[model samples]
Target: MAKQFENNMEECFSTSKGVFYLKSLSLEDNGSVSQVIKKRIEAINDENQESEEGDAFFVADIGVIKRQHKKWKTVLPRIEPFYAVKSNPEPLVLKTLANLGTGFDCASKDEIQRILDLSVDPSRIVFAQTTKQISFLRHAQKHKVKLMTFDNEDELYKIKHKYPGAELLLRIQTDKIKGSVNFGMKFGASLDSTKPLLQLAKALGLNIIGVSYHAGCLIAEPRAYRDALEHARSVFDEAKELGYDMNLVDVGGGFPATMEAGITFEVIASRLSQAVDDMFPKDVRVIAEPGRFYSTNAFTLCTQIISRRVVSTEGDSDPTFMYYINDGIFGSFRTLDFGYIHPVLKVLRKNQEIQDDWSGEKVYTSSIWGPTCSPDDFVAKETKLPKLESGDWIIWEKMGSYTSPASSEFNGIPKPKVYFTET
Candidate 1:
């Protein structure tokens, strides 16, 4: 099935009806929205015509990844992005980032080894996880992957004994944003505890080179970036007083892939650029660990509606329709737990033929589910969608990041195979 999807991409194959040039379609082309969707549906049907793989797959646009990198450079030109490997660790995504010269933010020994296998420089990888397994530390040392992070005093002792020569960044706790992923809870040292930790690192003769902090993932406000930068500056000042030549300050990952209305990347970048200029020196190299910002908008998910149910509702409201899709929360949607992500869904018109079910008062209140037997397998709840039937397909956008890498082949439902494209 994976091979067939790959072949379809290479052959630029489409159904006998016509070619659907979705690769060339832009988001701004609202006029071609239906045409693009029709093309995607055709592409999926053409590839999975005889497959028992349940007709669910992901389409990755390498162009979208490239465009995001360009946008990052255009916005915050100073800060280099270390693509978080945990986001979507698809081999293609990693290869695309490596080709773009983006660094990686790895968490486990496995992630580090994988990036290193790509012939990526050890310096281009940061073991961002503050918690260290001694064996993993030794593995990093053995591979010469030196840069890592530490927060608590116990981690200092572990690193002191396991990999004393490793260059370190003190991951400090930042202001917790309401409704954002509170990374500080698990990682980050308190501002008050940073000095003691740095003193301990000094006492142990360990190499503490700089500081890092995660504002929060899916930051709701741009002010979080500015505030986190300001907090990082204070840590830098303290590091200077402690006689450490802090050359870097990781303004950790909190960037969004696609911005909400009125809160644009331009606003965030402008704030970040100004903060970096004000807080740090010209020679000090600044970098970021941006996960979703680089990967989220790069892939599209195509799922077939396997089954559905209609249940009663109160008043004149349309009945609640349940849609069973091949993929679920356990699959590519594990990241949905972090924030309120409402995937923009479109019902694909097959062979450029509009379905009668999708037209005329078909806006039904619906919920989409995954194939797993677990009741927790809900994908989207309370979605207003056109009435759909079994085998009808839907496209979920902004699904590239935190989707595949986190998926599991649980309940005997295989992971969604991906089709990579330059378009």
Candidate 2:
């Protein structure tokens, strides 16, 4: 696997400083991911004895991403994946996807430039933003990144004036499903309005080559894809009536990233593929923008406990504890503010035997706080945890999506550093 990765990805890893390398480890040789995390913590502790630099860090498994790509190909061979760049713009992650020959869904000029920096062809990138900035439009035109999405007539005019030759995807709104992020509220043209938009584009002599829709983020309803594809087929029919030969379908990202998601990727892929096969001909190119699907499971975060405070409540037999970690909502845990649930916490005691299950140990009602001055800088509330001390570690798995990229250096706390490895 390492040799194959080296052969396919080494050229993309070259930079001005040096070539980036991924530490390859087999489970039989190096044990499990927990052991790797424990070893990393030990090395950091040994090196930072005087500095006391117990800052949070991440261990990203590139092999997981490679496996995800392989799985995508095996399950949804008809549809191509254009990874959502905004999910986690870690350079190595981008390079790895690019090496695997996956296209990109870029929302900004910088994202386009990042993909281009890896020597990716402009055609492999789709400017998936609905309302693009004029400057960003100019940049995309300059770089020959032609494919873009638009939902409104004003955007059609903007694209016509700025990039008349650009191929376009008319983004239609999906059903207003409950319990999911409503991307339709902010973007996507209504099915009623898609025809008018297509007509306007045809009148402007602008190219309309596809239809796009997002069924919202972390959506569990597989029928959302079915309904959205039906809506898209209607738009495609409208375009055909307007003499536009639409050939692409951009099934916008919202695929679940974790097993905890109410719906599995396999089920969603099966439904989507069946819908595509039923609704459209095989000649049409099918693609999806999957941000969390490719990223969420590939990275794990480990934060060191910076301080611990025991709080006693009257009439309570056990004292409630509040432990503070180096990283917080202002840093890598910012996704909590956006309605993401708290990550399951795993305790790693200093100089203690490593065990996956801690059910036998004594547990206490605890609350975890971030190392921030804000009152709302809480990581976990009223959670059960073992007795832990300062300098001990807390592990969070499946933290790759919308964590690092959205992190801020609020209250002077820096983002966690990422270390790359492969299994």
Question: Largest TM-score belongs to which candidate?
Answer: 2
The C-alpha local distance difference test score for the whole of candidate 2 amounts to 0.83
What is candidate 2's lDDT per residue for 377-407, written digit by digit as tens? 9888888888899888888888888898888
Best by lDDT: 2
Instruction: Score each candidate by Cα lDDT.
Output: 0.77, 0.83
TM-score of each candidate? 0.87, 0.92
Model 1 residue 213 lDDT?
A: 88
Clashing pairs in 2: none
> After aligning candidate 2 to the native by TM-score, how far in Å is the CA of 416 from where it should be?
0.9
Model 1 Cα lDDT, one tens digit per residue, 36-147: 4455456546765555545577767777789989999999899999999888777667767887999999998888977886778999988899998888889899998898
Which lDDT value does model 2 have at 206? 93
Clashes of each: 0, 0
> What is the overall TM-score of model 1 with all chains considered together?
0.87
